[model samples]
Target: MSVQRGGLGRVTHIIGEGLEGRIANRHLALFGLGFVGLFFVLPILLLIPESLNLGSTTPFESYRRVANGIYVDAFVRSFLYGFVTTVVTLALAYMLSYFLAFSTERVRTAMILIIVPLWIAYIVRYFGILLFLSPAGPLADLTGFETDLLFTTPAVIIGLANVYLPFAVLPIYNSLNAIDEELVNASRVLGAGKWRTITKVIFPLSLPGLVAAGLIVFILAAGSFLGPAVLGGPNQTMIANVIAQAFLDNFNIQFASALAIVYTVLLVGLLLVFNTLFDLQEVLGNI
Candidate 1:
């Protein structure tokens, strides 16, 4: 009886050790997850404390100093310009990507050649456009058209659209390429005209990619400062420019942090909406 009892005791100890090991492993994993959460949450957490107090010399004082209307207006203006840029860029990118997806080998090669300009440096692209639009530039010399577009809203829009065109195109192209050719052929065989097939079938199938491209361009355009600062005037000041002014011009660190947080939140909200509507991973992976 003693020998049997001793054997049971040993078995119980072994089981207890196994349970402890499992618990330790779970605790380690939880700790790692907590650390990761802290990594992202720390900055936002810091802002909240500052914004709430408003007395601190941090960037949060902007919430108190600036009127809600002005902040909202800045956001609205940024959204308006971003929306226009995204819409135009998406439409053009979709057309170009679709063409690349369906065109003959020679046409594909030609389209790639056209896309090569997108791979160049952004500053170079900006200057290249400037050279053509400036008073002494090619467009003025050829068409006799001239304007102070070198520092205007139109210039900012043009610069953003050009810079972000590739970001829009690459995703649409990948999504279009993944589509089964047989599906398109089947539509054509079933008495669908080219336009009808494109509108009803191709466009719907590529919606995910379109949304991805629009979101990318919108976010990029909204957060842009360099283009607007260099090419735009007071009328086209974006949210990013506002943040810069708060920090650099006014030396208002607390207000700048508040604006920065607001800007980040807006971008995050947009991204969440896009992810909810379309599979971001699928579209981004393709791009």
Candidate 2:
């Protein structure tokens, strides 16, 4: 009986040791997740009470103000910018990604070149665009034609498209790369021409990446402050710029917090809508 009890105790100890080892292996990942959650949650917690108008007994007053005409226009303009930027970025990125995925032998080199622009600071890139468009800048110097291009809606769109182009490219390229080569061959064997193969086979398979890229670019562009602030004129200011002005220039934290909360909720709602309409989980997984 003593021998039997001793054997059971040994088995229990071994099982406990294995569980500890398994947990140890996952500790780093758990810690990383916790750290990121804390980082994101702390700011949100700080903002929530302010957004609710803490200590003022006027909950949602700021939100009511945000829904007024002026702010409503800003929201509409922001969405417009997001949509236009998404369309332009998608057009440029799809072609580049397709080339990189299917036509290129130097895929690594081409990808590196495409990503090189991102290494420069975002502000610097915008400034470069500003300079290039300026009357005295290189474009004028080369063409001997001066034009005023700064502080316009077109300038803002150009800046956004340039800045977010790589983001769209990478996901689309990933989707295109994931397509089976055999599928393309099979399509060709079925008497499909080059254009038809691309339209039917490649494009359908790449929709996940395209959708993911569109969502990402639209979100970023819609929430953008710097691009609009620097490249846009008075009328081109976005919701993000308005939000910043509420906090910084006007020193209205409550209003700013309300705007932030509203904007965040709207974006989250949009994402939820998209997820319901499309298989966003599968799209994200493919990415």
- In order, candidate lDDTs are 0.79, 0.91
Off by over 4 Å in 1: 1-45, 49-60, 68-70, 106-119, 271-287
* Model 1 error, position 14 (Å): 37
Q: Which stretches of candidate 2 lie over 4 Å from their true place?
A: 1-23
Candidate 1 lDDT for residue 230: 71
Question: Per-candidate TM vs. native?
Answer: 0.75, 0.88
Q: 23-142 in candidate 1: lDDT tens per residue?
A: 767787888888877886786778655545445565334665555776777777788889888887888888888888887557567567767987787778777887877899998988
Residue-pair clashes per prediction, in order, are 5, 0
Model 2, residue 83: what's the lDDT?
Answer: 94
Question: What lDDT score goes with residue 239 in model 1?
Answer: 86
Clashing residue pairs for model 1: 58-254, 59-253, 59-254, 59-255, 60-254
How would you encode candidate 2's per-residue C-alpha lDDT over 1-287 as one tens digit per residue? 35555788889988987887567657878898888889987887788888777567778889999999989989889989999999999999999999999998999999998899999998999999989988889999999998777888898999999999999999999999999999999999999999999999999999999998999899999999989988888989899999999999999998999998888888899889989999788877766
